[model samples]
Target: MDQFTNFTRKVSANLTPFAEKVGTNFSQLRQIATEKMSNSAIITELPREYVETENRFEPVKHIHADLVRLARKYALDEGNVDFNKLQNQFIEITSSIGEKITNLASQNPQQQNTQNQTQNAYKPLNVTIQHQLASACISNSEIVGASLYKFGSTYEKIGDFRVKMNHDILENCINLLQGEFTSNIELAQKSRKDVQGARLALDALKSSLKGASSSKQAATAIEIEKAEEVFIIAVQDSMKHMKFVLGSPIIIESLRNFAAAQLEYFKESQSLLETLVTELEEIKLTQDALYYSEVDHH
Candidate 1:
């Protein structure tokens, strides 16, 4: 995140001057378009600032000088001019700007963005097409604001179509991020449920084993057998619930690995019980000592 912040800062710094120059050019064009003159479109034949014109057509001169200034400023800022790439594009845009402004003076308010275009009035398909394109462009993973504007037409009412486009893209990005967040949350809930079930099963199993180990002098063998049977049934019930909770492939694999290790410990405990019973069955102390010695050696 810190790295991303640093990268954005550097980008913003580099774009600042470029943004300023573009703004200046935009203002100059707006001023020229809005100017009112007696016999011509320009108010002052010669710009008060620039004074290099001789006997050339004055408005044409301003337009020429403005274009040169724009080209020079752009070149200085960029450090290189790619005429092969940008010259034709420049001519096309300048011509479009001239036509748009000319139409605006004739009461056809410049239809800057698609949304603000009035000629397509009463056309529902146009509206639908505009909205769908906007949605897809904004939601697209590959495009950002500038790319959308460079490749697509935008509206004046849509206002800095780049900004609106970015906002829409951001909304889609939020929805995508939220989906990941929700998936993680669900996984965490499942993990917690599995852990709780396993814990309860383990506790019940421990308690039952403790009860079996704590049996002392009791009634008949059948009664003792019934007591152990009851404990085993209770333990089996707990294990069934644990298995249900761990039925998922991921959980089952983990349980299989864990149970493999734990089953040995229970077997060792059973072996210890068998050894004690074997010692108890011996009638003589010598016999008990011999059996104990053999079991310890084994």
Candidate 2:
């Protein structure tokens, strides 16, 4: 009998906290329903400091979201061409060139040198319509002559610069902005939710105070004071979190990095293209003079 009594005491001890929690939850639910039905429950006004902090946070949140979106779009901005598809096509075309050369060399073993030259000569023209024309131009210029090859090489450098610029934007700007949103903004939001829950709990306890019997009124009032303290602390914590995010310089720094990367890319591309244009003009004049000389001779 003593053992059974001890066992029963242990079970009750284990269940006591759970029972209390369930009871508190039920009371809160009942209070919520009563207030919803009658609208007689007094709504507690938040402190002015908390209200001001919340107002300040609103614009920061809006701007942060907008910055994140703009950064992502800038990182991925490929005008009309599908960059991934073009890269894949370039890979496929280059890989096939090696395979075709190997097959031709094997099929005409005695005449491998002649066949290799002929096959390589025909390869560039074959890929012009199906692949990136700039890449095809590079292959063709390599076989035909040196002047066109230099122009194709400059064009290739521009393509490479664009790819590097996008990568830098994604790595340094977009990713940094996203990290701020996740680490700072989301944490502040969670703190705000905690403040709301603490406020609700304090409000629920205050509502219960009016119905307390004379014997329980003193203790109930004390509980209400403790709940009020908890709510105040929650508000302060939330305010601190929100302020940290608002005051952070990461957003501005990321934007600056993004702009700097773009500026460098454009500057380099413009320099290369301008030089190429001058060279092409000189080549065009020389070709024109040669054509006139041949016409006069005929």
Candidate 3:
């Protein structure tokens, strides 16, 4: 009985910090998103903030810049939607995870990590066509040749071609984020339900420990120890969920997608530009040959 008491207290201690951290993580993320949502959209348009308009229309680190411009403007400002119907996505996802943490604190531990099959897991609800391209898989890959550098030739087109390539990449990234936003929000809802089920099982052990007798208490403690082991397995999952609450995975994926999109443009532009230079070289050779033949005849 004494052993059970000590073990129960230990489990309680572990759960307290986990529960509190879960709350803090969710609140921190939701707060950051709320604070930045409106201003970020405006900042994305400003020169050199999220995008550079002069030399190259390149995006800066602010990946969610377009969401600031398009979603907030159309959905919140002009669309006339209510808060309940259209809550901010980050806030919504955090809220969903927060509820899961609350339920899990009382419930049984899970046998498997849900993070293995979370929203972006499995087949990927948001498929990135760019990631399929070679450039996306291989970052910063480019082709160079001596013919590309000839005076007033293919080298001149490089600057404009790169800019256009980046433009397409940024555009695709923006669209991808927009699409995944809703899907993740929905996943949060579903994850909450799955966690709730785990919570239900977890509650049984807690109840067993609540008013256990000398005989039953030992069994109860053992059951708790079993549940604790599960919690231990799922702790890594919790941390992943915490990061998901903070919107890191989506942002990281977007950056990768940008690189992938750029790769495609690099390949296609090199092909077309190299072909043009080759044709130009052939035409120059023909002209020289004709001139030399006329000179010989004279």
Candidate 4:
């Protein structure tokens, strides 16, 4: 873990300062640093964790759902917006996000308890799918960024390296995505077991809480309380397995780099779009001036 952390620190030390010099905002880069750099397993496990575990889940789910709804609202609020393009992009991005959420929610204790053996058997597959999803998200960001770069740069030879870099990043993401898809099938088989185990633990805790509240039986309450505590600890341990597999700092660092690169691409893209809009406005003004001038001369 220390070695991984050092590697991440070193990678950041090298890339971030240079990226800032090249014009990347250091602060608006949280998504890159936390989400991208964290192990793919952590990213995969987080959405699941926040969704599955009742004690730690409700607030997180509410926040996530709200974010999703807000994003949809923004897309729809534009009355003049191109509905097809806007909605399609929104759906693709959001749906992928939703899938991640689903995976998290599926980790109920009831499901996990029923499939313990199967879950243990399919660890490898789960790992693969998770890596794929994490890699794809990064790669997709690069692809979008590269397209923007190409459009923004007007295909100039000087921007060739940037374009090529984008392609390389895209390729890397694609490979990871493919691996994830392959692993996803195996992971599914164990999903039930994972969720069931978690649910059972939560159920036990709930029953204990009720016993403490209803009966004046201190001993029974203590026993239930201890059971609940034990259950929570067990759940935490299980989640760690899923989380650490991907939460490795090395993966996190790589994701950070990918995110940083994409942000650059996005900024460049926005600039290009603005330039195009400005040029069109100028052309319209020039045409209007020519028409008025000719009429006056006549």
Candidate 5:
């Protein structure tokens, strides 16, 4: 009986604070509801500081959300050529061709040795046009086929550079923007919620103050003063956090990194394509001469 009495006492001690908290919350809710429904209940006006902070926070919130969305869109891997996949496909095609060549040359030991040597010396091409033209070159269409192979090789390098550019943008720009949103913007949003809750509680207490009896009015006034201080502090914290996010240099740095990656990619691509275009013009001259010579013979 003594042990049971002690346990009961311990439980009651634990529940006492919880019960008081529940009662306080219920009173605040009742006051808020009464203020909303009863025309006789006085509605407290929010502080000007809080109202101004909230107004500034609203636009910042939308801007942060928009930036995060744009970051995700920019980081999307779709439409970008995958260099690894292209290389793998190139390997598969070359391996198949090598096997067939080896099989056909198997009847003659000398020819088989030559085929093996050719296969060992072959460089794998990633582009489809390169593979097709290389095969045509092997079949004796030398000029056009060799020129196309050179063009395709450079094109493959451009594809690799494009993939690298995409990765750099993701790592340097998109990731940093997302990190800022999570660390600063999200924290500011949470603080804003705290401010809103503190405002509601402060307003509820103020509305209930008018109904307090003379004997309890002094205590109610003290509670309202404490609530006001809490509301003010909450608003200050929220505003500070919002300002940090709004003024962050990370966003500007991220934009710069994104632009830099794109610029590098385009510049390199343009340089490579320009060189290939010049080479193609030379190849066209050779091709025209070969065509005219063949036409004269026919």
Candidate 6:
């Protein structure tokens, strides 16, 4: 028992620095994911409607819905104005805002183009669909990354339990390495979910566009299809965040480096642990005479 205790202490002293270095490497992986993988340019690649106002022909824009309430509040704060004159001026200002609200409400437009332009303000979201998809991709990527982090945290807890069970630094290190490997697998699972989440939102947005009666909305239907392509591409690109990324030659090399580190750590630690175990077993067998003498003396 004494042999095991002292051996574990020695192993802990050796492994603590390695654990710190692994932690630093993990931080670097996250930074790389944030810095190298995040692509905001995709947002700008979307349709103009996302970045600017749609070219709809509704005559009024940014109408103050509380204009009347504001005017009434102003009147209450001030000394009494002539009621008749205030009423005339209020009507004129409201009339200037919209023909429908004014005395000209009964008059129809003479031109067909003018008549056609005065339709309902039901603007569909076709123009900005691409940008919305891009935003969704970004949001889901963050969600998947967050999920992966949580998986790692959970695995770390399991590692703690394993270390407690064994009371060996070698066990602790091996458990932690196993936990990381499991969490890496979970990252891929969560990424698939991220893709599904983005797809569901995009489908819902497309459904909402179906109610619009504008000619532009028809054009937008076509535009949304293009946006869907971008969404898929963006999602594919987001997988670069994985520490154990797999794909092209450059990515595979990166994955290999991380894998190699983990494997090397495990190999070296296991080798050291086996050596200690063998030494302890030999001491336990050969030191029996001394051990019994000390026990008898005590």
Alpha-carbon RMSD, candidate 4: 28.6
lDDT of 3 at 162: 39
Candidate 5 weakest lDDT stretch, 10 residues: 125-134
Candidate 3 residues 59-86, lDDT tens each? Answer: 2223356653553343232333332333
1 or 5, which is superior by TM-score?
5
Top-TM-score candidate index: 5
Off by over 4 Å in 2: 1-40, 79-133, 136-151, 287-298
The collision pairs in model 6 are none
Candidate 6: worst 10 consecutive residues by lDDT? Answer: 56-65
Q: What TM-scores do the predictions have?
A: 0.22, 0.66, 0.27, 0.26, 0.68, 0.23
| Ten contiguous residues with the weakest lDDT in model 4 | 123-132
Evaluation by lDDT, superior candidate among 1 and 5: 5
- Per-residue lDDT over 81-166 for candidate 2, one digit per residue giving the tens place of the 0 to 100 score: 24344344345444665665467557753364455457557643222221244455655764655566557657656655665566
What do the candidate models score in CA lDDT, each in turn? 0.39, 0.71, 0.45, 0.43, 0.68, 0.41
Model 5 per-residue lDDT tens digits across residues 187-279: 988998787677667777776677788898899889889988998888788888877776778777877988898899789889988998999
Model 2 residue 263 CA deviation (Å) reads 1.2
* Of candidates 3 and 2, the better by lDDT: 2
lDDT of 6 by residue, 11-100 (tens): 999999999767645643443344455562112233433213212201111111132233333332232333234434334333443543
Q: Is candidate 4 or candidate 6 better by lDDT?
A: 4
What tens-digit string does per-residue lDDT give for candidate 1 at 15-124? 99999767645644444444432233323222222122211223432443354344333322233223342334334334454565566456522243333344336322
Better of 1 and 6 by lDDT: 6
TM-score of 1: 0.22
